[model samples]
Target: MSPQTDDVALSTTAERKVVVQSAGAQPDKDWVIVTRGLKREYDMGGEIVRALQGVDLAIRKNEYVAIMGPSGSGKSTLMNLIGCLDTPNGGEYWLSGQLVSTMKDDELARVRNKEIGFVFQTFNLLPRATALHNVELPLVYAGVGSAERKERAMEALTKVQLGDRAMHRPNELSGGQRQRVAIARALVNRPAILLADEPTGNLDSTTSEEIMRVFETLANTGQTVIMVTHEPDIAAHARRVVVLRDGKIASDERNQKVTSSLGL
Candidate 1:
């Protein structure tokens, strides 16, 4: 992640974020994400279902936040919108100063490719590919030259302290290492934000903590991270936690636990 300009003040407190979101305007570039009255709906057998009634969120660069909710809380819908996988029906969503809600499919695809790096619960690595090769997948898709792709992939892997494991296959590496490889791949593009959906779901408790520590290191290095999960303990690993209920944010607060524990 690149260092953000000092010209913009940090929106650290929930009160500050409220001020930013309530402005109902596109935030400046320093604020990487802003939403006003974001909404999502579905029609099931002629019955209308409101997955998200109205969601207003503001996130600045280099913040590590977690979005957590129980089943039917619309957290997934919010994640999709933030990840650029889906658009809201009636709201404004601005990402890095662009109105994402109005972008067409092609534009959304490009934005997704350029701005967001995603980590799924499933590592999603090619079984036959080595860790280095797996980390090169995104660059390969972007048509990056082979030499540059390999170089960037190695740099990404080194960020997660996995450079030594680059040539190991997924089956040969432990679950934690494989997840680290996935995280490295996500970081290869130097996206503005890293969006992870239940990234530690498949790992054991110890391995999960290992992955969280990697995230902690990344956040310390100025990576903007947004994690969506149902587990409170996992959410506690983030510097800020936003809980959603009934399709709206129920609470947003700084996590003293993570802040003090991680020296952030």
Candidate 2:
């Protein structure tokens, strides 16, 4: 399908996903993902549907930010656009100082693989593969040697406290462990930014809290994290919150304590 068509599909899928995964809902100073007047429209049954009207956002590197809004609020559309999995119909997007808005689909994919680490709500782990294998997939795409890929994957798993589970398949691990594996996979590349769409959507409260702690640790270590969430409590864990309403930012504020405590 065409890039435009792909963007539309992602919007529709995102809108639907936003309904069930609603949960809690970023940073400033050194913005890593910036967007201005971003818009996305779809030709649905010959009618146009606007997913994002105009969204303006700025996320800083090493900052933990959450995107929150109600169903049909265009939060998911914003995630897709920011993740570089899809592009906007009209807007200016600068990711790590690069004009991603103008890149072709292939170029976007290459940049995404090189600069972004994505963690999905579903964990997105390969069902039959060992955690080590799944975590190494990105390196394989980047053409890293097998020996180096194994070393890097193991190092990532260790960072997430999952070194012992590396030989286990997704099905063999618990929900929290699986998510950690996914997180390890995302960090394996050490991308410019980590984009997580409902990263803890499927986990229980306790598990979710554990995941948030991991994110906190990541941000503390200077890893940029941008997550989309619907629950206010979950969003509270972030250093900054960007509230979206009908695709426009309604509020942007930092948790002074979290921000100051970490010096982020």
Top TM-score hit = 1
lDDT tens digits, residues 1-264, model 1?
223421122355654556455555667677888888899998989998999998888888888889999989999899999999998999889898888899999899888878899898988889999999999988887779999999999999998889999999999999899899999998998889999999999999999999998998888778899999999999998878999999999998878786466443
For candidate 1, the per-residue lDDT at 117 reads 90
Cα miss at 241, model 2 (Å)? 0.4
Identify the candidate with maximal lDDT. Answer: 1
Candidate 1 whole-model C-alpha lDDT, 0 to 1 = 0.87
lDDT of 2 by residue, 36-72 (tens): 6789988899998898997766555666788899988
Q: Considering only N, C-alpha and C atoms within 3 Å, which residue pairs clash in candidate 2? A: 23-230, 23-231, 24-230, 24-231, 24-232, 25-235, 26-65, 26-240, 26-241
Error of 1 at 40 (Å): 0.6
> Relative to the unseen true structure, what is the C-alpha lDDT of residue 18 in candidate 2, on a scale of 0 to 100?
36
> Candidate 1, which ten residues in sequence have the lowest lDDT sum?
1-10
Assess the local accuracy of residue 208 in candidate 1 as a C-alpha lDDT between 0 and 100.
98
